[model samples]
Target: MQTAQLHMTMTGASEPRTARVWLHRYATLSAFCTLVLICAGALVTSNDAGLSIPDWPLSYGRLVPPLIGGIRYEWTHRLIAGTVGCLTLGLAVWLQFADPRRWMRRLGITAVGLVVAQATLGGLTVLFFQPPWVSTAHACLAQAFFCVMVSMAVFTTPEWGSRAGIRFSGARTTEKLAMTVVAAVFLQLLVGAGYRHKGLGMNWHLAGAVIVTGFVFWTVVRALRYNATESGVAPAAIALGACLLGQLFLGGGSLGAKLYYADAPQPMPIFVYVTTVHVALGALTLASAVVLALLLFRSEAQR
Candidate 1:
């Protein structure tokens, strides 16, 4: 009888562990899908296909329009967006029932809300003929949603829960700097989006880039120097640094592509490709900074 009881106890304990692992995997999947959706959106914008279908929630008044020219980019973006929405809804429902953390559940709901808003903004962009301000807002919100998805992935990681408390000198300063870096990166994204949509000038975007670069490096150096031994801190800082370097290179390439293609009748394919990759890399950079900030804040909270 005691053997059976022991077996049942072990089985019950293992069940939740398995479920947590699956939950984390699902969260990670949702985050990856979100990133892909962002890339699709960038492709549409870069190709000037935002209004190729001239309809909302459908293409050419059908479930699927003929994939030709700009229609293909626009339609693909819409389809990917639909997939992301479903994934996010599933993630939220799973977290609501399976996760024991109340805050995480709330975050899941918030993710659902953000996705809904993002979809609405997307539809508005199409319906309104892609107004610059609306498009810029849509782009900005997508980045925010991406960050939220990333946070969910991080929160669900087993290490997040099991992290041993470690004392890091100047943690408060590091956390504050990390927060500033996140804000700076986000603002840079805003400026870049505005420039892409013709709501702002390239000069402004360039200026924001310089400011963000300084902030990112400063934060990275501080975190690596002071919290290098901390489990999450060093990795997050390193990731942030690596993303910054890639973003800078992509930014320069995108600028060159645009200048070279400025006189072309339509956007050159190279220009489109470079700008699309730049947008995607920009999203990754913002996500990296966000992850770093979240880690810093988490460490601070644990104290």
Candidate 2:
């Protein structure tokens, strides 16, 4: 044990108490950057600004472009994406060296890989003139990347590694139900992405919304009921519920705005704002479900 500790210290482990807090903050910032990236992507789509720069990995052969018209949105989105990619890379490397858990190191690597793939897909979406499939895939991948960041955030917490395992009755059943809710939310996001990009999956998206909403409602109730025993359940459940309600309101506003401006010569600002917010809220909902599910499972496991 002394030799292992010596190796860990020499290999840049640093002080655990301070390093853990820094890791948590790093993960949180990565998640926030990802959220901003999602909003920027949404704005690009809602405003029909995807092709504003007409270049991939560059804007008109320059790293920076004049912030004008659609170029502002597109360039700013690219900047945010680049920043997120860098942050994820740093977090992954930091986890590999500083975090003791092998699984967490692997997750960090996976996040880096996903960020690279996501960036490639974003470029392809532009190079291909925003093909429906590519763009939809890009959108879906953004949510996946966001989920990864959220997981990293959760795992970095002191409680995650040190909490005493307290098994409650029906723990397995609760985990399974939470898993269902997470899956439903992800599927609904994918369907919604398709519908947003190509109008090809609105019916499916609507059906999925119903299913996801039901599962979310079920999950929230279970969490609340389990709150008497599990201290972690209530907060996560409340966050998920709030996100769901916001998503519902944003969805309605998006639809209403679209219909109200269906005959306009140009897309109205309100429509753009509503649709972007809807997309952003959808990402948040998925992240919340993912975090809640992971917390439930983590809480149930015997540490």
Number of the predicted model whose lDDT against the real structure is largest: 1
For every candidate in turn, the CA RMSD to the true structure comes to 4.1, 3.3
Please give the TM-score that candidate 2 achieves against the real structure. 0.92
- Clashing residue pairs, candidate 1? none
lDDT of each: 0.86, 0.84
User: Clash pairs of candidate 2?
Assistant: none
For 1-303, candidate 1 gives per-residue lDDT tens digits of 434433443455666667767888999999999999999999999989899999898788899999999999999999999999999999999987776666888999999999999999999999999899999999999999999999899988766744423344555888888888888999999999999999999999989988988989999999999877765789889888898888888899999988888899887889888888888888888888888887887776676
Worst 10 residues of 1 by lDDT: 1-10
TM-score of each: 0.92, 0.92
Error of 2 at 190 (Å): 0.5
Writing each residue's lDDT as its tens digit, candidate 2 over 17-100 gives 567778899999999999999999999988899999888888999998889998988999999999999999999999877777
